[model samples]
Target chain A: MMTYAVECKNISKHFGKTTALSHINLNMEKDKIYGLLGRNGAGKSTLLNIVTAQTFPDDGEVKIFGESPYENGRALRNICIVKENGMFLKDVSVTGALDIASSFYNNWDKKLAERLLIEFQLDKRKTYRNLSLGMKSQLGIIVGLASRAPITIFDEPYIGLDAAGRQLFYDVLIEDYMENPRTIILSTHLIDEVSNLLEDVIILNKGEVMLEGNSEDIKNKAFYIRGTKDRVEKHISGKKVLSKEEFGNTMAVAIFDSISDNEIRAMELDDLAISSIPLQQLFIFLTGGKMIKRGDINE
Target chain B: MNRIKSHLKMHYLNSKKSFVIFWSIMFAISALGILISIYFKSRGYESVIITNSIVAVVIFGAVSGMVCYNETLPYMLNMGITRKDFIFGFAIYNILLSLIMSVIYTLLSIWEWLMYKLLGFNYEHFGQFFSGVKGIFEMTWICFLVTLCATVLFTLIASIYYKKGMMFLFGIGALIMLLMFIPGVTQAVFGFLESLVLSCAGGKGYIMMTLYSLAFFLLCYLIIYPLARTSQIKR
Candidate 1:
């Protein structure tokens, strides 16, 4: 039997009458990166909070290394979640915060902390309140990477990082993750930028798990086909059509369903174009399908 | 217990600077007051250094406890400190802080009393509530209990606010007014609670007061743990 780094069963949460998550079951393996993609109010942060034991779910259990984290200090030592908002002591300096984190987490890496300190150009005495938003994000990224916990989570960790700084974060994350394999979950709105880094994907839509599987498999589950209206309609028959558009007699339709290569060949879109969708596009379609076509993106 | 100690260490390290700053200011004022007292005595005038440093210490201790619970809670929980550990650790520090400060004030008061003997300068202390060397232990225990009570009360209030925000106080206020109205109308329970408070305040009820304060302290912890257990960190 394989022990998961993080696992949840029948996880559900509610805020007043608003259901934040419902009957969501997920298992994240060790030494892999997962992209939790969702639109605004899609419950990504709520789910992450539950997994880290920062927030309790209304109905379910979350286990880190096969142990419930609630009041389980030994078990929780394996998890570190850096939120988008502040997590550091507001009055504590950069070094002070690191000292606090190092004391709490058993697997803290001083060398990694020092390297990130230099990488981010962080002054030792600059308190959390003194740092700009980008600096705060950098500090959080540094903590998430340096703690070297078995399960590390970053919820929209790039709140104010510049494009370059964000790239640096991605580089540091991948480099450190490669050196020391651990489960890492990055919940963010930057779908395109993190799509490549994700080994598996869990897409949430309105407090529900809409899609979750291997990243490549999720991307392969959807394909775009273009042809005249009659041909497009016939090809999409008895298939789950994700989105469609018609211009004059020509029509382009995106289908989101399991279709093997042989099955695609059977459809035989003669005098038509067929292509697989990018992960970001597929995510957009899966989440809302509001931006189904390239022309629809601008709106 | 080890976890609680580790959490206590974290809380201390995180707030050491603030602690130092607060105590430094308190002592600076106390020293300045002592200097002026010395000056008066040098001029052959009477000088009495009335040091209520116990009150200052208690206030600071309570406020620090409140700030620690309110501000560092999310970070502490995220850092893996349990609610029970946080309460226990914070309570330990508050009690220790109160005792230490109380002892320091007693010693200073003793010094001031010596000044009265040698230089005709006097000092008044809360220690006067008791007599002889026993006053030191008595006042120390009193200060410890008082500060511990205040600390736990503040923590309880912070946890309530954490659970229900400022609106919770309104409900409490409403209940207070309604209970007060019972004297005009009729409510046996309200009268019982009123008598409980009055009995604790009477001069001859030291044991009862200690018991009452301890009960309140335990009640505070009881209310705080559940509130904290369900508290959500608003990110």
Candidate 2:
């Protein structure tokens, strides 16, 4: 069994009367890139904050390396969070900010920082407040990757980056992860962009773990079967129906779990199509997108 | 040591521009004081000169609060350092900066006093400007302590509250204090503090007060450690 880097047990948090997170339990293994996927208000950020000791849970506890991370300096230095905004002193130049980061993170790799600075095309003399949103995100990516913490979490790492910058960030992240693999939790709404990179995917909905498994296993467990409305409905009658759509005489039913020979043969009817369900569609189904706006209900 | 040096270098470099404006204004004030003393000494005059600790307190408090608010507190959550490390690092940096500012101001005052005597004015007639060495040191130390405590208190408040929450907490705190209209509460609290201060150094009230002042500085930091560790970062 892989050693779990972060273990959370029934974690719940509240800000006054507003519940930010509720009954969240998670076990994250080391050396794997896990995607923390959720819609807006899914409590992904709150979970990350609690595990990183930035926020305290009202009930339940979190452990990093089998120890409570609260006020634990030894544990904290091994965790790095690259938030969306990439906070830094407004007056401090890029070089100055990097210098501060280096001093603070004992694991900081100067060479990696230098290379990333050049790759990201961020000016060393530009003050942090003056940098464009894309550049700010890039700076955070550099710090997160270069910190080389045992547990590295990035919350929406590519929010403002253009296509090229996003590509650069993803490419660099993959290359670095391969060279020095660590426990990486990437929280993002851009699921498709990072689909191929994730070894495991955890979908959070309403502050609860809606679905989690190996990426391939998760894909194999659900499939899209399309045919005549009656035929598709008969085929998905017993299996768990994740989602369904109908147009004219044709229908598509997303069935969870393995489809049997009879179900597969049901698609042999004329004008029928059977294909693998895309992860995004599964995410949408699991997150309750049909009934309400996904990521809207704050769990 | 290296980390401390790097932070200092960064702080100095980032603050150099503001320091230039501040020192210029300070120089002008020193020059004006010297000229005033010289003109007065021409006739018979004697009066005590006092440094405005309030101005120094505000400057130091604002600078400390702003710097920590911008850089230190926000990053502490993501960094590997614990709250102890963060508070200690901030305390060291604050103390170093306060020492530099106080020393510079003291030197300027001394320079003004010397200039007054050198401009053909009688030293005794110029008034007792120095207030002796111990007095100057005590005043500087007191100013540093006040600024340090006030800044830490501000940071603690900021750390625990932000935007809407900040206003709410402040409003609530003020409301509670206002509602506590009972007589002698203020006196009781002050008396308790005064007794604690006296006990720290065997009833040498002045010395104990100095030590308690230092303790208050540390106490503010201790109070904020848990706050920084558990506080959430607002978007």
Identify the leading candidate in terms of DockQ: 1
For candidate 2, what TM-score does chain B get against the true chain B? Answer: 0.69
lDDT agreement of model 2 with the native: 0.73
- Deviation from truth (RMSD, Å), model 2: 5.3
Per-residue lDDT for B51 in model 2? 32
* Candidate with the greatest TM-score versus the true structure: 1
Quick one: best lDDT, which candidate? 1
lDDT, residue A166, model 2: 87
Error of 1 at B127 (Å): 9.7
Residues A1-299 of candidate 1: C-alpha lDDT, one tens digit per residue: 88888888999999899999988888999999999998999899999988878888999999888899888877887888888985888788888888878877778899999998898888888989999999999999888999899889999998989998999999989999999999999998998899889999988878877777888876777789888898778767877777889999999988877776676785674666788888888777767745333222211
Per-model TM-score versus the true fold: 0.85, 0.81
State in Å the error of residue B62, model 2.
Answer: 5.1
How does model 1 score on DockQ?
0.57
Candidate 2 lDDT by residue in tens digits, A206-275: 7777777799878877788887898777666767777778899888888767766675665565446778
